[model samples]
Target: MSREPTRAAILIRESRKRAGLTQQALAEKLGITTSAVCNYESGASFPKAEMVFGLCDILDLTPRDLFECE
Candidate 1:
């Protein structure tokens, strides 16, 4: 099975796509840099814990959705 951290990154990327958001757009909403979003989607980095809820809101995902990968 894939690790939760890796799965979280994939979930975030897929959720963002489903929401019709570009990295720049999600970054704008999160008040972060586009490169940060790129890094997250690329599995280069993870968001801070406090940022996860906001990310979920913007991506139209529940926290469970981000962590439920197999």
Candidate 2:
């Protein structure tokens, strides 16, 4: 069965695509390993709350937009 897409995963995917960024590039911006970014995208794990905000800053996305929340 297919799992539902997570907000974080969707946001990360969209932001990276919009920026024309590879996981390695975004990982560099986050000061994290590329493997971590890969894992997050693969839904192997998730970032912390602070990292969520950090991702928003790096990705030029508002938290509401990133989460697609009302």
Candidate 3:
């Protein structure tokens, strides 16, 4: 089934862009595969808690920013 992108997906994608990092670059920083980043951005899967923190750090954002999409 086609799934709409989740809030987390939008947050990750926007934050990554704000940080000026491409999916490949973000994946390298997160030590994950590019497809993993794509999957998260596409809302095909959710990131683990640790990954959330990692994203916060790499994206120069807070958990609140990532979670609340503010």
Candidate 4:
């Protein structure tokens, strides 16, 4: 079955590409390993609420933008 993309997944990808950041680079910014970033992009895991703030800060986005569920 096909799965719809979650907002977190979409935001992770869009922000990374817009910033010209490789997965490794984004992981470094978030103080995580590249595998974590890869998982986030692949929709295998979700960031915690606190981590969401950090992600927004790093990606230059607001929580609303990242978590929008429509």
Candidate 5:
């Protein structure tokens, strides 16, 4: 596996922080479990396409933001 972080993980973490949202809070907003949020942030799992849009809306990020690597 690659050692580098996934863009989804980085974007989710940074955007969540910037929005002052905890995993629980974000999960609540998305109607998902906190563990799901954690998985996404840790790159252990990825959201579905529809969920991606939902996350972007809730986290104030664009689709590009989640795919862009720094």
Candidate 6:
């Protein structure tokens, strides 16, 4: 993967941290594998479109933080 992190990945990682959650904890809550959480945080892959909204709620991030705003 590229060295640069995706904006959404960075935001996810930051928000998870801000929420005081570990990768495993977040994965458990999201019903995903810890490795999958790692991939998302590392920007190895992107979360699905439907998942973004769930992530925003779980991580307490605004959609504007994970995505572009007009």
Please, what is the whole-model Cα lDDT of each candidate in the order they appear?
A: 0.82, 0.76, 0.87, 0.82, 0.86, 0.82
Displacement of the residue 14 alpha carbon in candidate 6, Å: 0.7
Listed in order, each prediction's TM-score against the native is 0.80, 0.73, 0.85, 0.82, 0.84, 0.84
Best model per lDDT: 3
- lDDT comparing candidate 1 with the true structure: 0.82
Pitting candidate 2 against candidate 5, the one with the higher lDDT is: 5
Clashes of each: 0, 0, 0, 0, 0, 0
lDDT of 5 by residue, 4-70 (tens): 5587798899999999999999999999999999889888888887898999998888877876743
List CA RMSD, all candidates: 3.9, 2.6, 2.0, 2.0, 2.5, 2.3
Q: Model 3, 59: alpha-carbon shift in Å?
A: 0.8
Q: Name the lDDT of candidate 3.
A: 0.87
The pairs that clash in candidate 2 are none
Question: What's the distance in Å from true for residue 21, model 4?
Answer: 0.7
Lowest lDDT 10-residue stretch of candidate 1 = 1-10
Residue by residue across 1-70, what tens digits does model 4's lDDT show? Answer: 7566677788888998898899999988888999988778777787778888888888888888866843
Candidate 6 per-residue lDDT over residues 1-70, each given as its tens digit: 3666687788788889999999999999888899988998888887877877788899877777777721
The number of the candidate with the highest TM-score is 3
- Once fitted onto the true fold, the runs of candidate 4 whose alpha carbons sit more than 4 angstroms away are 1-4
Q: Pairs clashing in candidate 1?
A: none
How would you encode candidate 3's per-residue C-alpha lDDT over 1-70 as one tens digit per residue? 8888988788889989999999999999999999999999999987787888898888887887666752
TM-score of 1: 0.80
Candidate 6 minimal-lDDT segment of 10 residues: 61-70
